[model samples]
Target: MTFYDVTVPISNAMITWPSDPAVSITGTSLISRGDFCNLSELKIGSHCGTHIDAPSHFLENGRTIDQLALENLIGEATVFEFKNKENIDVSDIKQLRFDNVKRVLFKTVNSSYWKFSTFKKDFVYLTKDAAQYLVDKGIRLVGVDYLSVEKFESQLAETHHTLLRNDVIILEGLDLSNVERGRYELIALPLKIKDGDGSPARVVLKST
Candidate 1:
């Protein structure tokens, strides 16, 4: 019963998405301040660090974070690896071996970017066509090793729209650097934010 904690640690030092609010942490109370207990203040974007994007993130009148079922958040998942990919295209998606797989996590080279302070502009991401492929394949949940599943340069964010419109759950900002490409039991539960479009999550994997 070995478990892999695949979530990236959320901290003020962590790289954040451009234009999003920077993570901040400060001590509100400390022993040095003559306080009996230590207290801290925290502020972060809803989608910071490891997170889940709900359908409402892109689709209008779509379901929110609290509305998501636990069954979709926890399940048997396939971890697939891709090397030397600038962006995940339809061809890459077509190569996946599916056997009643409802959840899939892509371990890409983008995970290496986690070590840098600067946000990577060229992170490996899913193309709209590849997103469509997943929708067609009936994937209930899709995860990525980077901050977003869609390309950074995408103005329209068609990839996000395609998946969200199809009711596909998107898990992003995963740190898969330690996890190998194989089958694992996924236990990713997001913060229960009411009517939230997205929220941070604690994602873990159990080896079978």
Candidate 2:
């Protein structure tokens, strides 16, 4: 009955992808200032910390966040740990068995980047070939421990395209540093934004 809350906390200080809007929070109303109730305003990108990338994130005619099926967001998942790998490539993908696995989360060295004060440009990510392998194997959802599933500054964004074009859900910015490699039930619920390409999500894992 144990649960793992793998979502990273959102804050103005949290590491964000370069060029993306930084998180901003301000107290619009405060009891200390004689306001009846405390109210805060938040300004954040749709692709902020701990989020899901809808197919529309890359595909021109793909489904938006609200249109995504809940069946794909909540289900059995497997967390796999990779050690000493710069990126998850075809060779690394070949070592695993996907027999009945629909959702997979990769816990890599990137998880340690969460402890740093800044974003690590060299964080571990998924290569295009590895992404294609997963799609070929019929993976419904893919999760990673960084802001992006693809290599930073990738010009083509091939990894993202490979998965998104096939309707595979991409979950990113996960704090998998404390979670062990094993099977669990994944519950990732994103804000139901209309025509949204991406949205931050509250992700949790329950022991199966």
Candidate 3:
């Protein structure tokens, strides 16, 4: 069996959402420095790196990250490759086969952006209609290669609201450059932060 670690590595210089807190990883006690043991400190946003967004990320009085169902975090998932240069519209989503699939991940051109340390504003994202399509198809979870599922600078945040309100788990900041289109067993576990709207996750895929 083969496995793929789709989670992005957290680093002090990693790209992040414009307004979110920047990642700050510092060595507090290092063996090289003659400390008792190697220890580090991390100061990052809850939504840093490859993370899962719960309903509380967008909806008021909604479930927090720790409240998300584990069934939705681990299961068989289908990966769809999208070559669209712009947003993922309904047409692109129409090509997907949603049968018997509880989770879905999109591998798009945005995956290429991971090579750069700077955030790209024009990365491909999902359209509101496409978000509704997934919800209508009974998708329990959705993953994207970039930092967000919605288009950059979106004032309404409809894509997030549409999915979150329907209890759809949003997995973002995945590194899917090496993954192919197929079915795999997804294992995405986020930090069990109490009252966290989102938390960084270590997402992995095992060949079925």
Candidate 4:
């Protein structure tokens, strides 16, 4: 079996969404300093690094991270690569057959931004129409190669609203640059933060 680690490494220098809390790690205990073991303090946003967004991330009355279905986190997924497209629309999604596809991960120019030293605000993202299209097709999970599924400057928060409102799980900040478009078995497990709106996840894929 060939396993692909699709999660990005999290570090202090890793780019995070603008306005979100910056990631920080500080050593609190060290064997070099006469401590018995090594320990570090970590501070990061719930949406930091590779993470999942629960319905509560956008809907007040929706389920939180812990409430998400485990079946949705592991499934057969299809990877769709989009090129030269600034925004993913419903037409793009319509071109694929979603039957038996529980999860869909999109690889776009956003993967290129990960190579940069700083965050790029122009990552390709989903338009509201595309989000709605997925929901209508009964997609249970959606993953993107950037910090957000919606465009950075989305005026109406339409894309997020459409997916979150329908209980679709959103996985973000994936590092899909090294992978090709194909069917795969996805394993994306988020921290079980009780009643929390979101949580960081460790995602991997095995070629099918």
Candidate 5:
């Protein structure tokens, strides 16, 4: 079996979404410095790096990260390779047969932009129609290789609301550059923060 790590390495220098909290790692004690043990302090937004967004992200009374089911976090997932499309549309997703698809991950040009030092504002994102389409298709989980699943200037915030309202687990900041579109076993586990709207996750894929 081959295992592909889809999560990005979180670090203080890693590029994050604009206006989001910056990641900081400070070593309080180090064995190299003759200290008892190495202890580091980590500070960052819950939504940083490879993360899972719960319903509370967009809905005030929605479910929190800890409330998500483990069954939804681990399952058979399909990776869809999208190109040249500024916004993923309902028509685009309609062509694919989502039968037995528990989770879906989109690999787009947005994954390529991760190579740059700075964050790209115009990365490919899901449109409102696409979000509704996924929800309508009974998709339990949706993953994207960018900071957000929705476009930057989305006016309706429909993409988020539509998915979250339906309890669709949203995974973002995935590094899918080396991955190809196919069926894979997905293991995406986020931090069990109490009542957290979202939390960073370590996602991995394995061929069955």
Candidate 6:
């Protein structure tokens, strides 16, 4: 059996969504600095790096990150490779075989942009119609390789609302460069932050 860690590394210099705060890690004590042990204060957005978005992220009175169940976060998942697409449209999504696939992760050109130091304004994202398509097919979870699942600067943000409103778990900022298109056991769990709209997650895939 082999395992793949699909989570991106989070650091103080990592690029973040323009609307979100930057990652910050400050040390209060360090063994190298004559302290008893190393202690650091961490400050970062709930959505930093590989994270899961609760419905509360885009919906009012929606479930929080703590409410996400382990069953939904860990299970069979399929990786879909999308190439030469500016954005994932309903037409493209309609062709996906949704049978018996509970979780879907898209590996797109956006994964290449992960090597950069700046946030990309044109990362591949899902269209509102495509988002609805997943909901229509009873998709329980959706994952993307970029910071957001929706298009950048979308006027309506329909992509996010449509999925979140329907209780679809949104996993974002994944590093799927090492994985191939196929079925695997997904293990992704976010921190149990009370009332958190989102939380950092460590996502991995295993083949048995």
Q: Where does candidate 3 have its weakest 10-residue lDDT segment? A: 82-91
Name the runs in model 3 displaced over 4 angstroms. none
Instruction: Give candidate 6 regions above 4 Å deviation.
Output: none
lDDT: which candidate is best?
Answer: 2
Q: Which ten residues in a row have the lowest lDDT in candidate 5?
A: 150-159
Better of 2 and 6 by TM-score: 2
Report lDDT per candidate: 0.93, 0.95, 0.94, 0.92, 0.92, 0.93
The positional error of residue 205 in candidate 2, measured at the CA in angstroms, is 0.3
Per-candidate TM equals: 0.97, 0.98, 0.98, 0.97, 0.98, 0.98
Expressed as tens digits, the lDDT of each residue in 48-99 for candidate 6 is: 9889999999888999999987888999999999999999999999888988
Clashing pairs in 6: none
User: Candidate 4's residue-wise lDDT over 1-208, tens digit each?
Assistant: 8999999888999888888999999889999999999999999999998999999998989999999999999989999999999888888989988878879999998888888988888888898889998988889999999999988877888888999999999999999988999899999999999999999999999998
RMSD of each: 1.0, 0.7, 0.8, 0.9, 0.9, 0.8
lDDT of 6: 0.93
lDDT of 3 by residue, 44-156 (tens): 99988899999999888989998999999999999999885688988888987888988999999988898897889999999999999999999999999999999999999
Collision count of model 4? 0
Instruction: Enumerate residue pairs that collide in model 2.
Output: none
lDDT for each residue of candidate 2 in 123-183, tens digit (9 for 90 to 100) = 8989999999999999999999999998888999999999999999999999998899999
Q: Could you tally the backbone clashes for each prediction?
A: 0, 0, 0, 0, 0, 0
Give lDDT for model 2: 0.95
- Candidate 4 CA-lDDT value: 0.92
Q: What is the C-alpha local distance difference test score of candidate 1? A: 0.93
> Clashing pairs in model 3?
none
Model 1: per-residue Cα lDDT at residue 98: 80
